[model samples]
Target: MNSVKKIAMLMCIGLPAFVHAGEAMVKWHDFNDYRDVRATNQAKGSYHKQIASSIEKHAIKLAEQLPKGYKLNLEITDVDLAGDVSYRGANEIRVVKPIHFPQLTLNYSLMNETGKEIGKGNDIKLKDMSFMDKIKMGRDESFYYEKRLLTEWFGEEILPKIN
Candidate 1:
């Protein structure tokens, strides 16, 4: 009876791990800017962390939108915000008005419970191409542009298939 008790205890401890092994969720790893020019300032560094956090939260919510055993793996390759700011002088910077277009590149894939690949997308770019034509970006607050871009992408790309 001692051997039986030990076996049962082992199973109880290990069963949950086995079950969660195939659990589905967002697997975002080592997300960082791949562009050659990188920001060195403290503000930009902080902003990048914030951006990553937002993406992680959104990805989790996106995962919950799908059925069980469906995992979405995403890698953010690049991030270019709406506007370009150039230093005009010693203490001033000139903002490029017409070129403030938000863009993001991601390599993503969807996998089922058994690790079967349902779909995949590489070099997927999410960009607001109609920025100059109709909608004018009026706000200059933090994360306004990037949050909008991610929200739109989640709504259009991920929500449809899940629903």
Candidate 2:
């Protein structure tokens, strides 16, 4: 088969699952009040939104585990990314160290197929102190540490409540 035909066939087979996958509702509190969300050298305006997008995307991926008609809602109150920003001669860079672990504070609720809340929490704090020691496949990916932290939390805290 031609390359275009092969690609089209693959997309046709995958589209339904992609469209039907569950998505989480993610909301962020005022970023201005957060502890840390610095993005290398970019201004706060652009980087903050990117950070939120990354988080929301990760949440949606996690939500795919929910059964049909179930939903996960997350309201993030704070975000402290895994690194501290420092200047390296004329350029600014993020320095990753053990002390500067990734942290997230949020509230979450899990709803059932009937729209009833089965599990919920307020001001839940998530942190990865041993982020560097863990095994991660995508080191160059955006928000690598933060996504890892969320993945761990979803599996431990959220998945258990559903079962």
Candidate 3:
């Protein structure tokens, strides 16, 4: 009876480990620039650069958080920017813009180092506020807001697929 109990315990532990070992590993692919906004918008050089930088930073952070065996590939396909200027109280200036955060039509695929796609996250939405928002809110605030939004979105969309 004692031996039987020990065997059952071992099986319970070993089974999960074995299952985990077989799980797929994820390798993220570089984000392909489908449409370069810089080429299109020749006017707002500084603003464009800021937006681009934010998108890249957010993409890299999110990619790093994926599960051990799964990979996410991000690519920026289209970028649309809209600016809204608002007065902050009496003599203040504020710009609330529809930055159209670059719509990154990602080609997410789960695979080993070789190249076989075990799973695919074809279309994922990564949207960020305008550069002014980031500056006003600060990096930490922006990061937290973005992280929460992504977590909620991913949990709803991708998490279901994984489970």
Candidate RMSDs in order: 9.1, 4.1, 9.8
Off by over 4 Å in 3: 1-43, 81-94, 97-107, 112-115, 121-151, 160-163
Give one digit per residue, the lDDT tens place, for model 1 in 120-150.
7888888786655655366664555556676
lDDT of 3 at 161: 48
lDDT of 2 by residue, 1-163 (tens): 9999999999999876764455599998888899998777888888999998988988998888777777899999999999899999999899999899999999989898789999899999999899888877855888999888889899998788777
* Clash counts for all predictions: 1, 0, 4
Off by over 4 Å in 2: 1-20
Best model per TM-score: 2
Tell me which of candidates 1 and 2 scores higher on TM-score. Answer: 2
Worst window of 10 by summed lDDT in candidate 2: 14-23
Tell me which residue pairs clash in candidate 3: 24-69, 25-69, 26-69, 26-70
What value of lDDT does candidate 1 attain over all alpha carbons?
A: 0.63
Error of 3 at 158 (Å): 3.4
Write down the lDDT of every candidate, Cα atoms only. Answer: 0.63, 0.87, 0.46
**lDDT for 136 (candidate 3):** 38
